[model samples]
Target: MAARFSLTFDSVDAPVLGAFWKTALGYVDELPPAPSATRAEGLAQFDLPEDDLPEHGVWLCDPDGVGPHLSILNVPEPKTAKNRLHIDVRVPGHGSPDERWARIRAESDRLVRAGASIVDEVDGQHVVMADPEGNEFCVAATSA
Candidate 1:
């Protein structure tokens, strides 16, 4: 069996970045740990100093429980270059190429409204975009 793991992102503002991805991927904030009523409470229990914890970091999970968990944590430095590994948001459909491209374009537009910026379009197959903090990802149309 394959092991499950999370994808972590370093951000300047974790909650803001987490919100953007949650909207982009249709994910939900992961529930706080047991014995805590809220994420803040859970973090408080750790008793870590402010310096030890990333400001307002958030954890998200796939609503269908299929995709990997996401951890967005704040860091001091800014993004300097292209991502070595990135996400591909696939919007698959059954139709002509134009119809399929429409689906992909619609999703790209929605993501743009959710604080992502378009970087490029590749041969009408995919759109490259960057999150608010400049993390790169793709929106692609695939055969269903």
Candidate 2:
């Protein structure tokens, strides 16, 4: 069996980053465990110190339950360098290369409206983009 794990990102503003990712990935906030209505309430159940509680973090999960959960944690420092690891938003479509590339551009444009900025475009292959906080990711279609 394969082990499962979640992705964690350090951010100056966890909630903002989380919101952007939620929209970009079609994800929703991970609900707190049963009996706790809110995440804050859930944290309260743990009896952790106010300072220790990750009040600045946000948790998100795939709505279809396939992808790993994403955790954005607030940190003191700002992002200083390009990410060693990143995400790729795959856009699948049918028809000719032009059609597929058009779909990719449409998706990239939507992301730009949602606070992502286009960094580079590699012809019909992919579009490199950065999130609001400067984390890099790509939007591309699979090669056949």
Assess each prediction's global lDDT (C-alpha) against the native. Answer: 0.90, 0.90
Q: What are the per-model C-alpha RMSD values against the true structure? A: 1.8, 1.9
For candidate 1, write residues 1-144 as lDDT tens digits. 998889999988998999999999999989988988987778887778778563558899999999999999887898999999999998967698888889999999999999999999998889999999999999997646
Residue 129 CA error for candidate 2 (Å)?
A: 0.2
* Model 2 stretches astray by more than 4 angstroms: 45-49, 52-55
Clashes of each: 0, 0
Worst 10 residues of 2 by lDDT: 46-55
- Whole-model lDDT for model 1 versus the true structure? 0.90
TM-score to true structure, per model: 0.90, 0.89
Alpha-carbon deviation at 79 in model 1, angstroms: 0.6
| Residue-level lDDT tens digits of model 2 in 1-144 | 999999999988888889899999999999987898988887787866567555699999999999999999887788999999999999976788898899899999999999999999997789999999999999998666
